[model samples]
Target: MPSPFTLAITGQSLIHHDIRACVDPGFLQIVEILKKADVAFTNFEGTILGRHGGSPMKGSYFGYSDPQVLDALKQAGFNALALANNHAFDLGPPGILSTLEEVRARGFLHAGIGLDRDHAIAPGVAAIRSRLIGLVAMDAGPGPRTMYADNARYRRPSRPGVNQLEVTRIFEADRAAFDMLATIQTTFQISKLERANYAQPDDPPVLDEDAEIDFYGTIFRRADVNRRVIAVDPDSASIHLEAIARARSREQFVIAYLHHHHWEPNWRDVPDWVRAFAHACIDAGANVFVSHGTPVLQPIEIYKRAPIFFGLGNFIFHTEKGETEWSSPDVWKSVVATCAFDPAGPLQIDLLPVALGGEERIEGLDFHERQVPMVASGKIAQQIIDDLAERSAIFGTTIERHGPTGRIQVSEGQR
Candidate 1:
């Protein structure tokens, strides 16, 4: 039988500062958990500013980290990183290239943004003790198209960007609302202007009498009731699945990851579309599926013996001190999941609750001391596990609590 392998997974790491010098007991405890695992994975949430110097693509919200932060993550025992996210292109193409260079130089197994379309979509593979682990990562965005990588064509050059899984937001309207929108469109002669200037030759065909109308770039579909629907482009999804399948065929334990900004009205609620896509990834031979975008933890699902984490929230969030958007306590509380896979036995997942600074006043701490995750205990730990259990129950995933930790055991028969 193959030897047992343990994988430690954490959420987004938007770290900008170094913490290798910190001797906090709580912080060190969190690091110890990661060190015990054969492989530890987290999403690197920002671009590394390196030799290929680049300019910021956004205003103050732009995310660019110094190279020393990579050293900090390595010190924290993270061996695998997912680099596909909204902020991956904060410093533009140069940032992508620089990050790729820095991560590769450190001997880290990283995937997501790459030199071109094919490279971005390819899996990052590395051999652990007794298993080969592969990571296929992507971003489903509400971001600019320029942020995504594309292949070199006859005339255009390849773009160095994130591996993008195209997603379309369709607004569903009732018959009356649909007709009113069409009337407004015709009255303003918007179609004429779009056809003459805005619409591309490859744009989806628009028919006045059809059930769907392309109002500018947004799609409005006629349906029985008014609602919003998130649609994943079939071709884009197929491409990602193909990469996962290819990696699995190579006998690698595949971990499929997605980073997206499309959240439900309630940040903690998992979107149906995302759940469906996670299942599709498991169907395509992904041994584990994880996602991180929303700053709060969502739900978990166990499908076909594979664990699916809809959103793992923030592991190491180092946002600006003045940023009040992440003030919610839920955003600061999350769990570190460790999955143990034994070839001759069952799969066991242990969850250790953690708090980012643990109810401390954000204004009191220095930049270096703030936003670092520590192991949670007592009431804080119970609260985190209870919330996670309640949400995960929606997907029929049961979590048994043991003191401050949670556990989920899947028998071999489930596989």
Candidate 2:
């Protein structure tokens, strides 16, 4: 193991148009740089699962890379991947299962999602020498309702097709039986809860009793056949707890990779749930919280001695043709704005080269391209680093920006 370990991270990137050329040789170069360090981590933004039947959700933009992408990461020496992101389930459970199978077969560790909410909270941890490393992945925003592993209908062979649920769902026939059963289960659970708590029998548990009776009545009264009691909402809290539990089991650094951000610059306000989740994760013993999903990077702060990296901007898309527009300094201002400099002085932070792999060209042809014209040329990457350093000053982020290399040197803050 390298004496001083280094790791790198980036944002959501896609290679939909030309999968092969998308990951250039520069990717290998980046990996070579990272190889000098102990381990490297990154978010696998696209799914590599082999399944094809899961109903693509409405209004969903899906991205997928060949399974060989995993081989590329191995060649690049990337040991871990955060799979808890929006696209992981684009093909539904089959996609997710295939992804898990592939990752396992490749001997790579992944976490932040699973067959159910419980799996989402458990993290992938690898013991590196005297230190332990953990990775978590989570997503925010709307998407398919994640079903648990044991849910009856979603079992191995036969499962209802999944699609991105529209804001307004019209009645569909296939959903009827499941909806009825779900109503029954829900009613029973509520009745059980009422019986358990039955506080001040006079009130008789207002929410469930009448609701249960009404639910049963409604099921019988309804003509619609398509009401299923599917677990629609993503239940991630338990997963979060389980992940922390795994981290604690190991005597090493605990890092959680979350795909959802607690705040966004464009959004004037931060959601309370977001803030609570971050704080809650920290309280549960996560040493570092790395979050993604926001197009641009966000702030990085240490709450209760636990650092939260709100976002890591897109790194692999530099070479892709159309995305070149994102190379501007202004677009990366948030990354510049939140970088925290080590107090000691200008010294290189452990730089790890994590590469984008596979093959594809800007013109959508299969070919090996090493350098992304915009970033490989150094001009844009350097400017992005410089711009971030400049903006970060406003946030009191004291970082050391190399003259034009965009390479970061974090200080230890004080002598």
Candidate 3:
């Protein structure tokens, strides 16, 4: 049983959600559960910086909780956090800088994003029970040019900066022909893009090919790794390689948390490019691939000897419309809507929340911890376990339950 290393993991995003609430009981619950664990980890969902005067993204919101949040985590007995999720850069460079500062100040280890290209690509290391554990964080692909961390305490990058990867795929069979047609179409899309002295190709699918090929071709060519027009999306092969490299380092074990957005359940809705992106992560030596951004809980599957827990859902979304996805039956509806659940199986993870009023609390927080457990009591926990078990059955994975309290270990050799 691998020495029965007691592990109690929670999936809570660190965005500003009811931050001022009391959380002593919640922290104590975690301390009680993970007392014997060699290490404990949580998902730092939001960027940790004070909301200074920084421009938020055009189509999104930026956030920053007080630096004390990191202290709250330390008090709760967490050793590390996966910082590679979607909202990591909600507030740009300043937020990123503050997040790093807070993490360092708290003597906690974080990974998945960094100050510059080099730092962002690097992995994080922490010592737990004398065992060195390596942590790596990555985004799905490239993002806007105007994104970054911007805190007054830290210096910002002067050049055009982007932290996400932008990758596309092409099938070997469609390469040469697709390229020929795409070149012509590319000329038509932007007449100025064509070289004045260059002769445009007179191909059958000139317009169609040019439109498809030009966009995909240019992007793929940027990295110079694409051959045929197989897929189109921002999935960076370089980041995948980096993750692989980081995981290969000598450590007790390597766990990577990547920020990607592929949470569709419909077989047809599941894009081929999305699967390819996930495959790239798996190929990169990632042991556990935790995905976010779909904002819903997906199935837990083992891919290429690694356990991939897609869409851990939102852990601490203060901005949610009302109740959390877990508190609402809609999550279960989505679970059943996309996949089936096994009644006689264990739960996927120990779903825990960061309750309020502990060592990590702000002076103004009014959060109450007693109400949280009362809301998710034994009966509710049992229901969640049953629901998750049934869903696991659909993926040929068995999730059995030996009791309640939202603690169900996924037995091996059951698929």
Runs off by more than 4 Å, candidate 2: 1-4, 13-28, 51-55, 58-60, 147-242, 261-276, 302-307, 317-379, 391-395, 405-415
Model 1 segments beyond 4 Å from truth? Answer: 192-209, 361-369
What is the TM-score of each predicted model, taking all chains together? 0.94, 0.61, 0.65
Model 1 / residue 218 / CA error / Å: 2.0
Candidate lDDT scores, in order, read 0.89, 0.48, 0.49
Ranking by TM-score: 1, 3, 2
- Report the C-alpha lDDT of model 3 over 294-363, residue by residue, as the tens digit: 5445556655544555555544445434333234332221111111112244224444323222222322
lDDT of 1: 0.89
lDDT score at residue 222, model 1, on the 0-100 scale: 93
Off by over 4 Å in 3: 1-7, 17-31, 34-36, 50-53, 148-163, 168-235, 265-284, 320-328, 331-375, 405-415
lDDT of each residue in 315-400, candidate 1, tens digit only: 99897766666656778888999999887888899999988875453323443346588888878899889889988988998899
Model 1's TM-score against the true structure: 0.94
Model 1, residue 56: what's the lDDT? 87
